[model samples]
Target chain A: MKMVRVIVSFLAMFFVNAVSAGVDDTVWKNELKTQFFADRSISETENIIAIEAPYRAEDAALVPIRITSKINQTNDKYIKKITLIVDKNPTPFAAEFNFTPLSGKADVAMRLRINSYSYVRAIAEMNDGQLIMAKKFVKASGGCSAPIGADLDAAMKRLGRMKFKLSGTAQSNEPNLAQLLISHPNITGMQMDQVTRFIRPAYYVEEVKVTFDGQPVLTAKTDIAISADPNFRFYFVPQSSGDLRAEVSDTDGNTFSQTYRVEP
Target chain B: MKCIWIVSLGLCLGLFAVQCQAKTKETLEVQKIAPGLYFHFGHHELPNRDNHGAIANIGFVVGKECVAVLDSGGNPQQGLLLKNTIEKITDVPICYVINSHVHPDHIFGNRSFKGRGVQFIGHKNLARAMQARGGFYLQRSEEQLGVKLAPKDIVLPDIEVTDSLTLDLGHRLLTVTAHGSAHTDNDLSVLDKNSQTLWLSDLLFVEHLPVIDGSLKGWLRELKALSALKVRRVVPGHGPVMGDWPAALKPQEDYLTMLLKEVRSMIRQGKFIEQAIAEVGQMATGRWALFDAFHKKNITLVFAELEWED
Candidate 1:
């Protein structure tokens, strides 16, 4: 009996070593659980939500990530809140977005600064108060420190200009997808001034509220982790032909708004 | 007829000389730019397998005790080649390897000098920057450029120069000055006291158009300070060795200044980035090489930066 037990233990040791030699299967998803879900019971389910990011980030600074709710829009199990987390960012919690029933659907896309190999999780809070999450393993590093796409004065001068495109032509009472481009510096306080040799103060857009014909769509509360000139894609139901407005406000208490006409 | 014949002969000789220089450039080696200073000029273009990542100006200052190498080439092979060239020049031990910035073309050659007991020097933020980018750069070297890189090829500096630090090569003390984000966030320039020659790595461009990867406002501000240097000659990162330096900076300055001034006006007029991308910098079209490929990125960067000013 002792000899049989010794053989089994040796075999188990060999198995552990062999498995460890390969990519150490503590997958990015598992890492996220430890990083964000200590002591909290978090539920992971498929098809409730799906998160999409590049398999490998080409430009670590500007990684595009999109999260879509798979639950039927007509169902009462709707997404009320979402928390964006990049596991390895210096500040791992990227942003949190809140929505109301007036929101057409919780399909949001934005750019993030992924500083390293991290599992980006989108935890959607349903109306029943259950949190469901979808994750993607993003193979990118060094997004937080990646230089903003431009110079100080130059990036600041073009601030507050917004452009948007509708994914599909508007139909009355149908939720349509919209992609918005907001030209804000989104400066994280970590960046240093190029000439002054001092840390540049943090200035970024804190809130973006989208409405179609004065009806609520989605209000996103963002942080510095959003890349410069923030981009967003969300769903909105157009009850009729009217103006879709994006009212953006920054940390400096500056508000910039732009309106786009959508035809039914 | 006699004058015409003389002119034709002179033109033939000039063309032949040009052809000869081009041929020699294929296996080119470093040349003496000043007393005790040697440099090799890289081609004016992007890095590729053919150039073998030698698209930046690399050189060394031979102090009496040892040699200080500035800006190793783009790959390990180029670094090895640079080492070989140094061996051929003199038998002195190499003391310091200075990286101009984090750009792959400049620091990839760092591994070739390993085991030589040399201290690698760079901007204070280099380790952080390299840590973030080293993996991707290593991967790209293999996939895109088709050049396989070992882990060691991505070298980080041990000696960080935050404000300014001077090192001795025995008799020569080279002052490595760290500048704020211009050209790149981790840019540093070296000054040789013995020769009074300022080596402005990528900070100044001569014939080729300056590429903007950092803050344009910051770059323009740095240019203003760099213009006051009273050096005898200047070594640019990707252009011919220049004599009239601060003056040589005018064309690049003009282009960047115009980009800022006009782009700001465009924004103030409520013209979007799409319009600025199409119309800005059209006047400087014929004056620069690879303008079409790199100009839009510059405009985009500048426009994005300018938008936040308000």
Candidate 2:
């Protein structure tokens, strides 16, 4: 009886230990360090780049991230590219933005999926071979698990219908802000179909481009971290009284475009 | 014999610990937001890697003979616990249950009060929203919380208030104000006159950032109106009880003010949406920490609404 009791105790202890070893916070931190330096280098100079986000997110998966640059305005040169990276995402590269002077302030905002509390870094490369960066930490979790508020079929039915709004007097000297609302599911592939228990495949907004009067304003390339029903906003220098056009294409080959007339 | 006894003791202790931990009834801390009103802080727990912390709040108003509950809880079981807590304190039956909005967290526990013949109240739009998405919400709750809520558990609101309505809780007079086209079209706020307490469900997220699925202008106006009210205390949908409602109002109001002003300014400057987002970066940084997640989204929504023609 003593021998049986001892064996049972030992087995129970072993099972508890086995379960505890699976989750490692250090592993997540280490993975972030590995990806932090993958393609971008940190810079110390103030490069007129800024990222605005909520200090704490109401929803982790749908936390809005925006990146903007002022370097081009001071130098009359355009930015080559901008990257939004989340240090801890399974795929850390949230989005990459490309721009031209016609792209205006090189700013863009989109909803993203955050697996946990993590730092978000926005890096912009100027045409003059300079990289400027800004970082903000957002507190939002369970974005990957949040249920789609709308029916899958209904959400899909309205996918890719874009709306553009250019507010303020078009004739004013102030810069015009144009917003684009895109209807897309942006499935991160990590979520399971609730009914099927099958892992959904990754599909997101891979790229977006905006044009002001036929002048390129901003371009974005993203990963699976984008939330469903992604909406984007940016600034552009409206030169003439022409239509501001937006052309967006997701990874799934879905393309959408909309044009709003600028007030003279 | 000694070794066997020691082994059995260890096993018994382990079983006891398991049972203790499995007891999920947590003692909730309640605070009086108004004279006759109380708000209970819902516990925050992340049970699984994929699940987010539950942040719903429960509110109740004590009257002469009965009490009214607003927004039961996140689950039926939780609602049962809340009911038990209420029963222990008072003999008054729960006379009314009002869902401030149709969000699952705010209304999922409707079933716990159904069999008791309580009068359930909500916006006229809630029944449709629930009927459309009730099954999906149930499935997700089960998947995420490991707790299953039956379809029959949800009780449709017998009283649908449109515009505004006042409820007389006998000793305490409570006013239910409906703010259409903010947060959600069916949003409502409960105000208790005797205690001068206002239960701003989801309208005011005290310490946490406010989520705006509604009109920024409308929400801002509602906040302004509430700020002008003579209430002594306010109970937010999420966060601790608020003694100074204005202190809790700043972050959200500041955010909306900054978004509308900055985005409008950039629009006037002829900057497109992308440029405005970049240029408006960190404009309201020092005010609130949660600005990062909501700032740009606010700008996007505000810009869309402002630019829309009548």
Candidate 3:
């Protein structure tokens, strides 16, 4: 009986180690919870939102992540905001996205720079002020490629260029997918200049506001973790023929705006 | 009789140790592709702990007055092996070490040739790329390549080639040309005037799947410029050297062109990147080695670039 007990304990320990192989989840768990929602309880379940990410990213510089809401965006009960977090990144807080009733759906997709293998979490704050969370483990890519933008020159040459891609035509009072493309080299300040031997300062998009017919749809505050040439896909509902406008600003105080007509 | 037998055994052991040392110091194997031009072909495999990143074609050109090392090696030790090979072949001193591009596999061996009177040459943008990527490369070399690299391993070029530069190695003259963004932002190709041999490093891959770390459109455009060149034979960064001038470039061109076309059409269909990555390259498999390793990343990069097209 003693020998069997020892074997069982050994197997239990091995399983525990295997489960917690990557960076400690508790670091981000405690730190982010304390920082983002101090004195407030957070529900650690996929009841409100769920995040989708590759189990192993092929490119560390551009890992695609999407967040889907289980409930619809209604005035009475809706997801008001969602905060994305990477546990092992230099900055655990990646971005915070805010939505209004004008947003037909709370689904969003974007690319991020993951520095190391860690848990990616999305915390949703509902209209009732309840905070719900979803998390996924991701293994960061390892190779010759660095977690930085490729073709910085091309991104710089077309800086502040913006375009709107709408899926099919807009429908009245229903969810329609729209993508916004912005050209900006989100320099993370980690790279050193060979000749100058100096670290470049971090310059990235600080704010993004999207509106339809002057009604607010989505607003996001992001940091350097956002990939260069930021591309965002979201859903917005148009009542009739109107205009969709996107206004973006960076840390350097540069603001760019573009407007596209939506014919229902 | 017993004492003599013991003595002979010790002698035999000493000889074995000496033989081991000599074997370790054996020079890297190289083939003389042309008169005064030597080439070393690297195997098509991903950089791993077993290889230590020594997976790029590296060689040298011997001239009357001096020798020019085209690329060093994948690591400091590989660089040392290459230096030993050069010493065994000729007595001329090495004058210039020309780097092809910024990939770690191509430039990591630079530390082996760091000495006075041996000037390093590269594209004008090479230093900037090295500076931007050197720290990250140094940090991850240990975990990825199983070799810990210091800041010294990331050497910058002393001389930059903006448009074109010519170096005289006595009877041999090498014309170094800097290309626009193709394989990478900084790509330099060397042409030997006397032999008409062009060393088109990663810019042309004969067998290995060509990696696209730069613009897909830019690479297609650079292919046009490279195909128009007139040369007796060309050296690729990977695979065998070919005497067929522009004809040797067809495989890489076709691969890049197919990728561009599929990605553009996917964008036209309003497909997302994930959908395109899954459905785009089904037909092009088994054509190139390391396709599974690098194709998805290539599709992702090309999709990101072409989606913004007007």
TM-score of each: 0.61, 0.54, 0.92
Q: How well is each residue in B215-240 modelled by candidate 3, as lDDT tens digits?
A: 88998898898889899999999889
Count of residue pairs whose backbone atoms collide, per candidate: 19, 41, 0
> How good is the docking of model 3, by CAPRI class?
acceptable
CA lDDT scores, all candidates in order: 0.75, 0.66, 0.87
Better of 2 and 3 by TM-score: 3
Pick the winner on lDDT between candidates 1 and 2.
1
Model 1: what TM-score? 0.61
lDDT of 1 by residue, A68-91 (tens): 888645446678889898765656
Per-candidate TM-score, first chain only? 0.80, 0.77, 0.89
Which lDDT tens digits does candidate 3 get at residues A130-239? 98989889887666667777787888898999999998878888999999999999988776454344556888998999999999999999988898889899999999
What is the lDDT, from 0 to 100, of the residue B115 in candidate 2? 63
- Worst lDDT run of 10 residues, candidate 1 chain B, spans B137-146
**What lDDT is reached at residue B100 by model 3?**
95
Give the number of the best model, judged by lDDT. Answer: 3
Model 1 C-alpha lDDT per residue in residues B1-310, reported as the tens digit of each score: 9999999999999999998865543333889999789999887776654465678889999988889998888887788888888887888899899998887888988988877579899998676556544655665464334467766676778799999999988888899999887777678999998898888898877777777777788889988998898988888887888888688888889999999999999877756555676789888989987676467657766765675565
True contacts kept of each: 0.10, 0.03, 0.43
